[model samples]
Target: MKHPKDPSAPGTMRVLDKQPTLQRRSFLRGGGLGAIGITVIPVASLAASKDVAARQSFRHLGAATGRTLVRMARDIYPHDKLADTFYVEAVAPYDAASAKDKGVKKLLADGVKDLDQRARQRCGVPYAEVKTEDERVALLKDIEATPFFKKVQGDLVTGLYNNKKLWPLFGYEGSAWEKGGYVNRGFDDIDWL
Candidate 1:
């Protein structure tokens, strides 16, 4: 078939026969990569996937239950810049110094499990499942009143507070010498130093 723009040349079409020269010039300048381009897709997809993966990774929060604990940590340790860093490290499976002391690791796990179960039994739902802020606060109070809760809270406090990352958050003014120095914390008598 012969086209009007290229009638003299049988079956040959002018690449930019009917288009405006400006549009043609712009298209040619793009090096045939299409007007809007292609390299943007994978980068966008990867960013989205990374966000989803990060959310999914923290699905199991043990006894802490829901993002509320994270919020609580923020409130309790507001000044701690390494709160998240220490928290993630703390929430992971425990790794103590000795192999036989693995029992202590189990004890900590059991303590958290017991606390969560207590919350569920008292409230008819897991602590994480509670919707209202009042309910969460009330649940914490109930836990505090119990011996088991005291024990668990003690262990958790010990574990979490011992974290080097939490020292500054708790106002522990220790030297940052890693582990050997006078941590002259002035929480006691202000005049006593």
Candidate 2:
């Protein structure tokens, strides 16, 4: 089947497809994996290596908790959906968390289902299912201002606002309070002429 991004390609996308016989044959012979396996102790060690590699690649605040934030953020700021990018960074960190991460887990458990239902009711699509930008944003504002939406919105936004990665996504240039985030972002230069 053709890749959505590259219609010209006819077969299934394969990273190895670009390589010639020697590299592919060596890979099949377990060239790299065999060497690494000798150095790495157990099969789980390889998994741990992958986990570390994933964490090193990006810093994800909102997505570190999982798809709950993605769903909520999509609901709230539909047009500026950064969740897809954030999710790429978050997968490892999110999977690393234990069951004891009560704060994030509760936030997801409490808000996701209701938020999804509200999104479906207001827009005729589930939170995860919505396709259009305008419909998503309108539903988000509705969820934020309505009394019925108050509790869940508060919880979800609180979690999102607290995420370390959210600031970059929102263009938050830091704050004047606590540890001088404002100074770090150089908020002192504005002259309102």
Candidate 3:
């Protein structure tokens, strides 16, 4: 009478079987670590979990819009050596500003929509989903003069590149105060006049 899924089980583990409920007291008595509950779920469920996490992560922008912003930011900065994570970090303040200001939110939404529409006209795809970098660059160029683009560029100029976490990536040693100021550090490293 072993279970089909679990050979050691004494019965069949049917799909319709009711999952056991755990009581707090019983859970505590069971040495929780030893009686850890495990459940098998469909891949779709895992995807949904990721979707939920993504939704929570971006407060102001939707996934598609956020993606478009990331691309635009990368284009403006053109830091091919840096990872996408830096771009995401750079755009976080924009997202926060959008969350706090309705006008900013509308501007971002409209900007994203405008970019997508441009992409559609050029390549029949959304801006965020555009496959070719050339097309993306073309689309961005079309909107480069817009206030939306300028705002994004201005915000990212300082926000993205100024991050302390990213300083070391570009050979920046950060503040000189930590190691007893620039006098002791390599402030005078310039030897070749």
Please report the candidate that would top lDDT against the real structure: 3
Candidate 1, 49-143: lDDT as tens digits: 43221243433333243233443332222222332434434433333321246555455445446556766777776655556545655555555
Selected candidate, larger TM-score, 1 vs 2: 1
lDDT string for model 3 (1-193, tens) is: 5446874576654465577775432232212321223323445544544323234357667777877888776666655445566677778676788888989999999998998888888899887678876677777767778889878877876777588876665667888897799986987887875
Candidates ranked by TM-score, best first? Answer: 3, 1, 2
Better of 1 and 2 by lDDT: 2
lDDT ranking of the models: 3, 2, 1
Clashing residue pairs in candidate 1, if any? Answer: none
- Candidate 3: count of backbone clashes, pairs at least 3 residues apart or interchain: 0
TM-score, per-candidate, Cα-based: 0.37, 0.35, 0.64
Determine which window of 10 residues in candidate 2 has minimal summed lDDT: 30-39
In candidate 1, position 69 carries an lDDT of: 40
Q: Which stretches of candidate 3 lie over 4 Å from their true place?
A: 1-56, 177-184, 190-193
Q: Worst lDDT window (10 residues) for model 1?
A: 30-39
Q: How far in Å is the alpha carbon of 68 misplaced in model 1?
A: 10
Write model 2 residue lDDT over 1-193, tens digit each, in one string: 5566674576645454554433321221212221111111345533444423223432232332344445443343232223344333333343334245666445444455666677778777666566765565555555555443454344434444555765654545455577756666566677763
Model 2, residue pairs in steric clash:
none
Model 3: colliding residue pairs: none
Candidate number with the higher TM-score (1 or 3): 3
